[model samples]
Target: MNSQQPSLAQGLLAGQRGALARAITWAENADRRFPQLLEDVYAAVGRSHRLGVTGPPGAGKSTLVNQLARHLRELERTVGILAVDPSSPFTGGALLGDRIRMEERTLDPGVFIRSMASRGSRGGLARATVDAFDVMDAFGFDQLIVETVGVGQAEYDVVGAADTVLVVLCPGAGDGVQAMKSGLLEVADVLCINKADLPGADRMVADLEEAVHIRTAGKGLWMPPVVSVSAGTDQGLDGLLEAIQSHRAWLEAEGRLQLSRQEQRLDQVQRVLREGFDHAIWEGRGLEGYARAMIKASRTPHGAAERILEQLKAALPSEWAQVQEETQP
Candidate 1:
């Protein structure tokens, strides 16, 4: 462990809010001390139920999340919220910050809220979102909610990381057909039609219900429930919460919670490995010069890429040689 890591880990374990914030910052920046900090606190993770909220930009996702957080606190549950906002073009930090609207909960000691910039990361989440969630979980929050920037269909990555994914859609926002077209239904554990009192809300709900039914009819798969809510009026919020709880109960009863978490952790491992490889091979090993040299030799980009792959394979340990040979055509 590094010099500052132990103290940080101890402070985090002691449930210090400052420690939690700093730890998340370390995760966000990919700081050098983060790995050891995580290692020291990893065992405390997995206790918090991660809920991911995402959808179209005007879906009222932030309002719904605020309502949900308020309701959870009413139940005496400690909550940690990571709101991933769009990046500022220049600073690469959260543009709206949105924390201003969450002022009610901001002063509540039981609630820990952080806004992260998308930082040009795709899949509706900042690359550091899960890492921050893990640290928040280790800090002993009973529930953690992740709200994505809701850029579009590609934002499904955040849902994959959560225990339950709530895809919120408001009526007349391209209609429910757009949801189906964008493949949003495929990732929804619970489909929340917010602004339920709107003119087309019922039609939107019906469309989604039919879509979910058709998609899961013969597969014996769990069909995501379509629930309606008016976050603005605080109406039907209970039904949304009930749907989330029902899904959680189903996962628990079917013994699938651990399996799902394991899969998410595996995905995290793959992401971390890819990042590490990019840093090690491209930056540490000076592979950029080699690429430039190959281009200077009049090689096409694809040809140069193949040459680089060969070099990478050659540098691998002897144990991989036979496997590499067998895979080569």
Candidate 2:
């Protein structure tokens, strides 16, 4: 702890566990040392396989991740999980109840589970998540799982980071397949119809197959497989894991893995810039004053937002001007 940044970087590169913990803490706090932490951990990058699990709520995403983590540990692989939970809009505190579902693994030395509050940071996660992944990667975890806020198109951000994104969907929800069709169906590298014991499992699987056939049509990519599993019963997990391994094999065999990595790198850069710019806008004051004025004058938040954004735009870095222009109507 007494050492300076260079020494700390050396310690981390040497695989000192203490330095890894300190680095993760610093990144989570959004400390000024973050960029340096990433720099130090750069050599450790590309060592971990990033897997993202997503889907509608109640699709057993957490359970699937837990199962996968245990499977990886059995292979002597260390695992890190970033579980994104919704924050209370009123209090900014997270429910973070995922711990209950993962009680069996709490004592496992090979697994590290971290719950992150979405923190009003939209797009399915806090901006610091990629940094958090870097911390875990540098800490020598062999695999990392990022589980995003369920539902909504924005949650597909996970796909951008993952080598393979498994979209979990289950039967019994009134509109489960419909919900999948909306956005979940498109980005998924693997589709799981969980709770296979439930009624309509066959129907859901058939629906998903048809959806994939239509979407991918002739792309010649390994068709995203539709898997059925009953997580509660611990059924079909091995097959699910096999499917994941198969997808990874296909990625490597077809040379898409490197492409995925390249896309992920570009995505991280864009996301970091976007979040930094948004944080700057929200820093000095709450938006309450502007909201109140808009309500009083009967103007939409959209109009006021445009004016405020124009003001914020002038001070933005030139690179962001391109982003602003592309987003403009």
Q: Considering every candidate listed, which one attains the maximal lDDT?
A: 1
Model 2 over residues 55-117: C-alpha lDDT tens digits? 877788888788888778888888888898888889988789776777777878788888888
> What C-alpha lDDT does candidate 1 achieve relative to the native structure?
0.88
RMSD of each candidate? 2.8, 4.6
The TM-score values for the models, in the order shown, are: 0.93, 0.81
Each candidate's lDDT (Cα)? 0.88, 0.79
Q: Please, what are the lDDT tens digits per residue for candidate 1 over residues 1-329?
A: 46889999999999999999999999989998998999999999989999999888878988899999999999999999999888866876566656776788988999999999888787888889989999999999998999988767666787657999999988888765676787778989999999999899999989999889888988988889999999989999888989999998888876799989988988899999999999987786578888888877755888888888888878889978788889897
lDDT, candidate 2, equals: 0.79
Displacement of residue 242 (Cα, Å) in model 2 is 1.1
